[model samples]
Target: MDPAVTAAALDDEHRTFARLLREHQGIVATVAASYCRDPHDRADLAQEIAAQLWRAWPNYDPARRFSTWMYRIALNVAISAVRSAALRQRHAVPFDERLHDVADPAPRDPQAEQQIRALHAFIQAQAPLDRALLLLYLDDRSHREMAEILGLSETNIATKISRLRQRIRHEL
Candidate 1:
């Protein structure tokens, strides 16, 4: 192929990647916020997720939804960071009170806010896999997509979600 043709191809690929990333940037932010309590750590995790997405771009299948692919990569990176941080710290991080600080313009319901805080605390206390499942479940992902992103069977995903729901009801 001519050099100019190759350059144009590369440019097109870059543009596609950029467009996809822009469209699904919320996935990165949500994953980072889900995994990291500190704002600094969340920013770092988001950056790492974006970098990994770029590195993995060449392998992305165009037939699939970009959001699914982005979620898989983002969750994997977030899980790895959580594991690494756990190994280094060898202790659980303190609960971030900032998660409770909701800035809603509408009238706030105190009881609902308390429930939300409890849910956040419950989620934070969960293991990485469970946390990921809860995030996926809360995001209204279908079991098939959850299975694909988490590399579990659809049956397994269903079972886990059922169990997690039971656990939440029992504990919270």
Candidate 2:
């Protein structure tokens, strides 16, 4: 491709990606909050997810749904961010006394929110992979999509989800 053509193509792709990002940007926050306990750290994690997505945008396969690709990137970034305590501390936030605000758009229910907080606390104690699966499950990803995102067989996803659900029910 000519230099000018390549620049124009990149510009167009960036615009489209920005639009898609606006629509589904909630995934970044959702994944970040699932992994990051501090509010400011969560914000930083979201930014990292966005940066990773921007870097990976050129390789995005158009045939797949944009949200799926974005979800995969967000989760990968979230997982990486959690795996390194020093890296997270580099972006560390002093604990905020205010309740952590979720990206949920539903009408606010104090009772429901309390329950959700409890659920999140439970999830926080889970192993990394279980944490990922439960987050995907809470996000309502289909079994096939979860498998694709996590690089597991569909059967494996189903089994894991079942076990996770059982564990959540038993523990919660």
Best by TM-score: 1
TM-score, per-candidate, Cα-based = 0.88, 0.84
- Tens-digit lDDT string for candidate 1 (60-116): 998998888899999999889878945336434223445335323455589986877
lDDT of each: 0.82, 0.78
Clashing pairs in 2: none
Instruction: Count the clashes in each prediction.
Output: 0, 0
Cα displacement (angstroms), candidate 1, residue 35, comes to 0.9
Q: Highest lDDT, which number?
A: 1
Model 2, TM vs. native: 0.84
Give residue 79's error in model 1 in angstroms: 0.9
